[model samples]
Target chain A: MHTRTIEILVGLFLIAGVVAALALAINVSGLTGSNNGSYKVYAHFENIGGLTKKAEVTLAGVQIGTVTQISIDADLLVAKVEMEIFSEVNYLSIDSSVQILTAGLLGGKYIGLSVGAEDEVLVEGSIIEDSQSALVLEELIGKFLFDKVSE
Target chain B: MNISNKIMDGIASMGRGLLDNLAGLGRASMVLVHALFVWPQPKTSFSLVVKQLYNVGVKSLLIIVVSGLFIGMVLGLQGYTILVDFGSEQSVGQMVALSLVRELAPVVTALLFAGRAGSALTAEIGLMKATEQLASLEMIGVDPLRRIVAPRLWAGFISMPILSMIFAIVGVYGGALVSIEWLGVFSGSYWSVMQGAVDFYDDILNGVIKAVVFGFAITWIAVYQGLESVPTSEGISQSTTRTVVYSSLIILALDFVLTALMFGDV
Candidate 1:
């Protein structure tokens, strides 16, 4: 029984360690912004590969905000991605574009927003005119492999 | 019989055995369900859980920690070798972190725990049955399932994630150390790449959830096999072997399922 008590205490510490790790992982991104009232915007994509709710959403090569939600729009037949951008970042002009881009070959995809030279800023509810979906690397690899075989 | 006939007979016998085991599994599930409802009071069950926690968690820590260090070092070495091909050897940190958090840490830690704590749980319970201790408990109005099995289950479920986290942390550190000192990568650049590669919550939650599922599978199979032990010593030994094998198989299967559910959205 005495040995059992010691073991149980050790077990609790193990659990605590796991919980600590998870907490650190969740809060560790280290990307924080000044208190700017950033408005919400939604982007529609066919597929946002491996992009989870807390994924980073960037504009003009700079991370502006994070993905707030990802849901399927039944009426529109598309993936609706909601993102929150800081209000102070003024680079998102009217003609700016959003593209789902990969970090590297096997890394997670993030929304990459490129700025347009337009003078007017995109207001809330204004959709970015042009967007590109993620390129499925596996599919591309398969195509290349098959093409080589056929050739 | 001739060779072909003998082979066919063996296959048929194996199939029959599998079917019989499936039927037995169904019966065991029923027994488990019955045991759950008729279990003893909450206080006793809690104590059982406490006892299990000690056995599974505390006793397993040192092994988990040492395992973590070696896994980390290997991951670092392997990742550096590949990254060097692309002149991106500094990316070893990220590679080590991703590999450990995403796959190796959870799997290795679970395997270790299953081989150690899981086998022990099965053997102990099997021995109890073989010695009629389980029956004796019942005779004294003690509900063995709630007291003995439930705690072990809870202990396993709790310990797996904890052990996995320790493994990942240690592994990443080990990888970084090897990459810097042995591989001669610039420490600053290596760490920077790792810093960029890992996002705290996104990467960390993946391991935690995987560990929890692993814990549940290891304990459940171990305790279940143990509780179902026959009276003979041979029966007890057989159950112990089965518990270890089945627990490992279940762990791998669960890893696939969880990975698909969690990361397959891409």
Candidate 2:
């Protein structure tokens, strides 16, 4: 092969590798440019247990949105979570119940949605009623210990 | 000889063969390191290395792209089913990214590199030796190690990591295409969840490091096996096959060792 051709080939190879690496690195970590067609919903919990921002909100085991914000209700002294559900899921009923459920034995916490028997549809910024707090492992262990001690 | 004597003789020969393999491993490692020290001693080495970079890295692009896309798509589909059970199918990006960066990219790229570039290197050097071209160069006082082996070895060492990274990057895009476009996942959740979970230094850098190490090991075996083989057509062919076999085994074993050291809890 000619020296010039070899140089061009090497340059192309290097460029391809660099671009791919950059793409891969970008894909793995940093700000997600995934803000496409998502709308917000609200749910309140008494104890969120290790739940943080960007958790999942699902209906019937299917992901419909993300937990975009978390804050405190000053009067209720409880946690409030804001979710960004996709616009396509237009019929999440207002009477739907949200629960803070853990995945597997040691997986992350997410909000699970179960639709209630109601004809009303939830528009943007609507609040989900009948939400439950996260099932804290520490609390479960403590309660178990107390029950054993008393027995 | 009696049956008992024959059994004893078989055991003795096995022990001797084991010793020979150990000795060969020691000798091959020494020669590889020696070539590394002599790598920069030649004026013509740069152009040759570039040629090898094109030969190995550029030529392998299509294979890498095709396989990377398929691997990513498969992971996305499979991970969706499992993650859906956990109500976290949106995190399919995390599953694909972590799996590709930490394992599949390096290991698969290295295996392919061995079969493509590594086998060819062995065949090329073996042919040159079989035809007495190496002997002619040595007769004129030109060192074959500097002229022939060093450039190819170094080129492979550099190219492996780059190819692996490209595979990983392309793979992530493939996964995104499947999970987001095909499966109707929320587009934003895919990339963002991946970003939230994967670590840069812990996962990506370690994968690149593994590729570089695998490159050095595979290329060293290829070049050494070819350069030192008996100067015959059959001998050359046998050594080329051995290059692929040995590189595959060593790549897998070294991956285990490196993973234990780099990602182990200790």
Candidate 3:
């Protein structure tokens, strides 16, 4: 091939490679726009049960936000989970319930939200009052065995 | 000869071999430092780098794409089978994507590059040496290191990360083809879950770093072997083989260290 043609092809190749890297970053890894236009809300749980930061915060089986931080509330002796809810989801009632739930049988943990009937709406820095801690399978099994022995 | 004399001779030869290997390593490091640190004339080197990029990067695209696709398809098929037992077939996407982006793309691409471009580089420069072209260039006031070696080295450095990214992107889609099309995996979950699982900084960027490092090491070894060859046909063949072998070993070793540093908790 001609030198000019080769140079053009090489240029195209580089552009394509860069485009691929961008796709991997944006499309595959979901790198951008993750926390944009989002408001923070806190929920306290007795046990988080392997719930990690960046885990999905879903409502009605659709993701609405992500878990931003998980920390221990020393005063309450509970897990204080911080979530970034999208600005579009600004209608969550103050009394809305959040539960730490697992996906599938052996999948990741996420926070599931159920809207409540209330006039007040949750805003930034609002604490979600109604929260259910994640179920520890080992505890449940242990309780079941103890009940069996008692019986 | 007595047994003691034979034992001493064996130990002396082994020590000599080790010393020779160490000297070779030191020389190779010097060549790499010179090639990288000493900037060539930018006016003419642009075209040289472009030419080398065409030869190294564009020529190697076919094998990378084909291998990436096949490897991803196989991963999908195998991952599905294993995950099906756990009733987590939807995770096949994550499995394939994570493996390809984090490990397979960089590692496998480097191995293939060592075999394909690395050996070719060794042989080409070895031939140039054998034909006294490099020597003739030196006599004519042209620095062969600046004109030839530097361009090829830069080409290799630039090509590797690009090639690895292409390999990963192609592989992910190939995996999707098999999992979503063939195995009846839900397409939405396959992609969404993968996106959720793969971290841009931890996985993709780290993988790119690995690719760049591998590129530098492989190209450095190739050119060094070529320049140091005995300037004969037999010597050229030996150097080519050594280039491939050494590149592969170094890639694997460096990969382990990089992975530990990038991914390990420690």
Every model's DockQ: 0.20, 0.36, 0.67
- Write down the worst ten-residue block by lDDT for model 1 chain B: B31-40
Over B1-266, each residue of candidate 3 has an lDDT whose tens digit, in order, gives: 69999999999999999999999989988877777777667879999999999989999999999999999999999999999998889889899999999999999999999999999999999999999999999999988888889999999999999999999999999999999999999896788788889999999999999999999999999999999999999999999999999999999999999999999883
Tell me the docking grade of candidate 1. Answer: incorrect
| C-alpha lDDT (0 to 100) for residue B86 of candidate 2 | 71
- Give the number of colliding residue pairs in candidate 1: 8
- Cα lDDT of candidate 2 equals 0.86
Interface RMSD over true interface Cα atoms for each candidate: 5.6, 3.3, 1.2
User: Model 1, range A54-79, lDDT digits (tens) per residue?
Assistant: 56677655568767688998998988
Q: Output the better candidate (2/3) by TM-score.
A: 3
Pull out the clashing pairs in model 2.
Answer: A34-B188
Give lDDT tens digits, candidate 3, residues A1-151. 8989999999999998999899899877978865669999999999999998878899998888989899999999999999999999999999999999998899889899999999999999999999999999999999999999999
Q: Deviation in angstroms for B8 in model 1? A: 12
For model 3, the superposed segments whose C-alpha errors exceed 4 Å read A141-151, B1-16
- Candidate 2 DockQ category? acceptable
Q: Enumerate residue pairs that collide in model 1.
A: A7-B54, A8-B54, A25-B200, A25-B201, A26-B200, A26-B201, A50-B266, B72-B171
Quick one: best DockQ, which candidate? Answer: 3
| By lDDT: ranked, best first | 3, 2, 1
Q: For candidate 2 chain B, which ten residues in a row score worst on lDDT?
A: B34-43
